[model samples]
Target: MKWFYDALNILGGISFVSVAVIAYFGKLYFERYKRKQDEKIKSLQSRLDLTNAEMKSKLENINHVSKAQFDKEFSIYHEIWSCIFEVADSVSKLRPVLDHFDPNESREERRERRLQAFYDRYNPLVVAIESNRPFYFEQVYKLVCEYRDLCRKEAFEYQHYEDYPNFKDYWESHEENMKLIKEVMQKCSEAIRDRIYSLTIIK
Candidate 1:
């Protein structure tokens, strides 16, 4: 009986020690897991912060480039438009008297009037833009639109009379004007493209 009681006490102590060791190891594992979790969270936060900064920088660059390009293109568009309108105004004046000459109108006189009208109108806008006057482009753009409108009306009136023998010379001038306006439009488009390219967006 005495031996059995000693053995029981020894076994109970061993069991208690085993349980304490297990609990200690469990606590250590839990602490390690928490630390790893914290590290991962910090890493993710840092990456997100970096990404945010990069995004902001890119957006700012885009805005800056866009503004610059818009200003440049606007100047060109405005100038070209004004030129077209001014030239159109001078050309349109002859529309009212166009029918007065009838089909027998001399083509040379018609061509001279048409060519001279365009020549008289175009120099002012070109000179302004060439001199780099501010806002000159805007004025030109408005004028060009006005000219286009007037030309359209003029074309309607000339459509029937243009093929007549005496009116053939006038057609040359009319066609030349169309060609010039189209060329100017092309110039404006090219300027816009060049301006955008020049901006060179930072990001």
Candidate 2:
């Protein structure tokens, strides 16, 4: 009976030791797993932050480039409009509403002077349009070309005014040319306005 008791006591002690060992190892494994999970979370957060920062930078760069492009386009458009206005003014001066007869200037001389004035403005307009050809829409470019052609035709007709039978014939033809020019100018202006409106919306 004594041996049996001793054996029982030894077995109980061994069981206690085994449980303690298992608990200690289990605690260590759990702590290690928790630490690994924390490290993974930190790594993922770092990657996400880097991605966000890069995206922000790229967006800012794109906006800056878009703004610069828009400004350049606007400047070119302004230059074109200025040239058009000058051409319009020259057109008006070609046949003044109130002619001041200078006895010193012959009819041919007056025609030459008016044509020269048109050329002065027309040349600049040509340069502006040609230099920025790529910047204009096809329709706008065509309208400008049409305006140029009309001005040239007016100049040609005025130069050959002596060919006409009477002043009435020449004046009537000149008025018609002026009317066509005015209409084209209006169309061109409206086209430009529409283009600018579209660009504004995109911006």
Candidate 2 at residue 129, lDDT?
79
The residue pairs in collision within model 2 are none
Error of 1 at 1 (Å): 33
lDDT scores in order: 0.60, 0.80
User: Using Cα atoms with residue i matched to residue i, what is each candidate's TM-score against the true structure?
Assistant: 0.33, 0.63
Q: Pick the candidate with the highest TM-score.
A: 2
Model 2 misplaced stretches (Cα beyond 4 Å): 1-65, 200-203
1-203: candidate 2 lDDT, tens digit per residue: 88866876787865776798899999999999999999999999999999999998765544222556667766777887788888888877877768776899998888889889888998988888789888656677888888888887887887777799998888899999999999998888887776554453234
* lDDT tens readout by residue for model 1, 59-161: 5644334555567655665665576567656655554434455467687687566656765766665564555545323444444444455455445445446
Off by over 4 Å in 1: 1-80, 88-101, 133-203
TM-score of 1: 0.33
